[model samples]
Target chain A: MTDGFVTASGVSRHFTPSLPLGERIVAAFGGAVERRSVRAVDQVDLSLRKGEALGLVGESGCGKTTLGRMIAGILPPSDGALAIAGEPVMTCGASPRKTTTRVQMVFQDPFASLDPRMRIGDALAEGPIHHGLVSKAGAVAYVRDWLGQVGLEPDYVSRYPHQFSGGQRQRVAIARALAMRPDVLVCDEPVASLDVSIQAQIINLFLKLRRELDLTLLFISHDLGVVRHLCDRVAIMYLGRIVEEGPTHEVYADPRHPYTQALLDSVPKLVLEEGAEVRFKPIQGELPSPLAPPPGCHFHLRCPFAAERCAVERPTLRPVATGRRAACHFAKTDLNIITGSSSSPAVIASGAKQSS
Target chain B: MIDRASPLARFFGEFRESRAAVFGLVVVGLMIGLALLAPLITPQDPYDLASLTLRDARRPPGYVGTAGFTHWLGTDAQGRDLLSAILYGLRISIQMGLVAGAIGLVLGASVGTTAAYLGGRVEAFVMRLIDLQLSFPAILLAFVIAALLGQGKWQLVAALVAAQYAYFARTAHGAAAAERHKDYVEAALSTPLPARRVVFRHILPNALPPLIVVATVQIASAISLEATLSFLGVGLPPTEPSLGMLIANGFPYMLSGRYWISIYPGVALIILIFAVNLVGDQIRDQLNPRLRR
Candidate 1:
């Protein structure tokens, strides 16, 4: 594969659950103990060209945030390599440490993201001043400039995080990340906790910042509409694996994987016809425990079109269409059409687009 | 208008809204002021052996002594004026509590927060040590240390710090551990700021409200513990009378007809501890974010 500016090849993160106190003592005394691993991000190949916004979409526990953290260099992958501009972001070892200052992350909850005791100016200047990007004397003006860029007033500097409204705090968080002058931004559900109107405002701010800064973005969210609006390319993750990836327009218009289709199908649709009943069909079953994921295809148990072969054999992500890749046994054949599964609003939307 | 005020001014403003807290603050201030001004305000120097006469000893309240001085609270067995001795004792008690509590707060908070921030084995080791210290009754631990170190003002303060630091460490560890998972700490970690800065500047400040509450309460307890050790005759010596040592000196006189000697100093210790506790309670209420309107 061509090396994108930020390249992640087979990156994975696993968490081993510590034994209970009694069991730990037993294990310490040379007795056997069971330890289970949660495969948060299984081997996933992905890359982002410089200045491109890649939206990572998944269900709540599917590890989109984990992937974003790994890309941001805040979290080290348990396996595989992640690099920014050919420099490894983290050292691979038992105790992995992030090696780069080129990537930064803006977290989801603004109320929790900025230090409560910190003044807005200090919170914004902390990174720049520490990294020697700005002198202490210059940090005030530097902080003020970034705050203004994020649409906050320069005078709001001295106010603590609690003094600001949620939207204002989110703006501060964004300004703080940008103040670090990082080349890549991994925004882990940045606007997911905002009010709807505020979400639009922040999204627009992100759009403006991305254009002006030429920032590489790994935008992680479960919100499809926001992802479609902000991202140039989109990757759909399921149970720690990317099931489909393509240009945002193409993937939204023509998703190949069953998992991606189910996700797209779940998006609430507008039905304005008089007396027309709106249908609400959620995906069946719980996400199987990551501790002991099923053999072969992880999604096979929950898959509506799971065949015998799908239950016994795993599918690797491969080219399915122009600029699109999907991991499925029959990516070329459009399974929804073959199986005559529940009619997807996504397909109907695509049909409308083709006709128009 | 309130938003425009400086933080210190705003804190005081909010602090003033609690009448009980203000009252507590005033009483604590009076006690501290009286303690500091003991030598200047009191008529007799309680430690001046040349002045004290056993002939006037055990005098009832408001007796005219041979020295031509008014014994309002009477005198102890050594003929030391009860009021003068208490003021001196208050100074020693307050000084010891503040010194011990402040030192312990710094040491314990640093250790606990660092352990919590590091997590895993380091946290387990530090926390176990804290637990071990805490399992011993605070007074008992102080007694052992005071006995081992011998009776002196600074030695007593050292004992109190050793006995009291575990509480601070436990509180700090709990608060810092909870705060370690907060998004702000994670955001700090993502920055190139050193790990120490992340632990102290980012996590510690957020963890401090509870620690402040703990500090105030611990200071009050420190004063009480010193009193207990002295009452048991293991604390400050007679030459250096803390409230505890004063009470100890008068305990033998309590069985006799003269109640003024012991009762007056007992009252003083109660009033001091009460004032400290009231102030601590007010501080806890004011510092709690939930209690703020």
Candidate 2:
């Protein structure tokens, strides 16, 4: 009971893609055929207390969606453990039927998420009907209520998904998820595919739902501004690991991890400090392929403050403050040092030279 | 706030783009009408053994022969009314196409969706079998099946279905496999809903449009396959006078001067199959988002 309603400890998802036929045949014949396993979610720990809105922010392929999916029970973790409401969430078809109803997910793409053949009413009513919360006779009224909860008109219930706009369809998806009456709602970039104007509306809807429903929200997004606006706490992910996590405002005001600082810096804003000489730009280097993640710290290759020890020793998440954790060797000291010297490239180059 | 267009509006808009589809619709509608009204429209029961005679056999069109207007399209060398025979044939052709299509569609869709949803060895086994079936041309497979069953109504339909269901299954598998991983399907499975319910209710419905278009096309092919088997003398008995039987019965006389015997029924079969194909193509094109323009 002390832990959050949903707890994921060292949960990971790895996929071993099969080779094509020609390559398979060659491999079968003993010819060399390389096989790579993608560690999509690598030993990530997350916890969500009831009625808490925790935003998971990361670049694409950093396993934000994968982590969300694992939480929602759509996918099983490759290793480690997860518990919902102190009951272990079983992977590989072992969880009871009731376990599925306890957590639900809202997907990113509304266009592809809903069945085009299904009427909106059926989509909304399916969960309640399946869960035996309502009979067929009562499903209509129940679905209407859920539809209203998602801000959709109950009159538009009979329409197909293709008949609705993307935003409307997303509302239906939310209603569909909410219909299960889940304690935890894992929204995997639900507003990423929406328009900027529409994104705000959906975010506001989520905020309102959080207030009214008192649901635990594991909101995954790359949008830092949206995360700051909607989340009470935010976890920054880099290469399938939570590099830093803290209260949203505190994290925004001062991100301890270099990766989090770089991510926050990338957000475009209208305001600028008058006569400011220092400006923030996106971090250098592409996100390395998950198949062959760099040794030690995943972000060590891209980190500006990479000293000799940073390349060889992988940093574990450690407590930096009362309710915050960061997985950097120098999370507290890096920002002060970077600010003190606007031209800090020479120090980083010299460190790398010394390490080599 | 994008205004929602009704499904009917979109369908009609797509239909208007293809004139051949409209023509096909008319022809198919006429054939269906002919099937339903076969008993009322036919001058004599082609199935009635006592009605056929040698005297009215092979008479040319507009004949002042024994049957008069009954020999309007000329006799099929059995003295059976050609128009009556054609009408009866429509009934059988339409029934065979629909029944076989339905059977094949249901079986194939179920199997395909199962294979796709439950991947791994299930997919491998089912898909390899579909591949094996696909390796042989559909006609050869149908010919072998019909050859085994000999000649009858249900027998012919069964053979055609056995030969045809694989393609429908393949179509369903391809579409269902694509739809299987979709987030909504995952979301449905994540509910208290059973895997079977999710597979059928959510996954299957999304997978059906392509299967539906394929079913229409399959019906046309099934009819053609039935006729081909009949023409080869293994489909229906001459007693049935299916369009293929009529064509086969009259095929020998085409060497002589009497061309109307086989020519008329042949034309009917062509029109029937071609019209169905046209409808299928139009529906497929309409369903395909890539071809929407």
Best by TM-score: 1
Best-performing candidate as measured by DockQ: 2
Kindly list the per-residue Cα lDDT of model 2 for residues A1-356, writing each as its tens digit: 13877899888889999989999999999999889999888888888888999999999899988888878877778887788888765545544343557888899999988877788898888888877878999999898888888888888888888877889889999998888888889899999999999999999999999899889999999988889899999999998899999899988876777888778767766777898544557788999989999988899888877777678878878766668888876656333234222234434543443442
| TM-score of every prediction relative to native | 0.93, 0.92
Cα lDDT tens digits for candidate 1, B1-293 = 12556666777887788787778788889999999999999989999999999998878878888878888898888787888889999998899889999999999999999999999899999899889889999988899999999988888989999999999889999999999988888888878677899998988887888888899888889998999899898898888888888877778877777877778878887877787777778778877779876
Chain B TM-score for candidate 2? 0.95
lDDT of 1 at B155: 87
Q: For all candidates listed, what's the TM-score of chain B alone?
A: 0.95, 0.95
Docking class of 2: medium
Output the number of the lDDT-best candidate.
Answer: 1
True contacts kept of each: 0.63, 0.75
- Candidate 2 residue lDDT tens string, B42-72: 8888778687778888888766555445467
**Which stretches of model 2 miss by more than 4 angstroms?**
A26-34, A90-98, A333-356, B1-3, B67-70
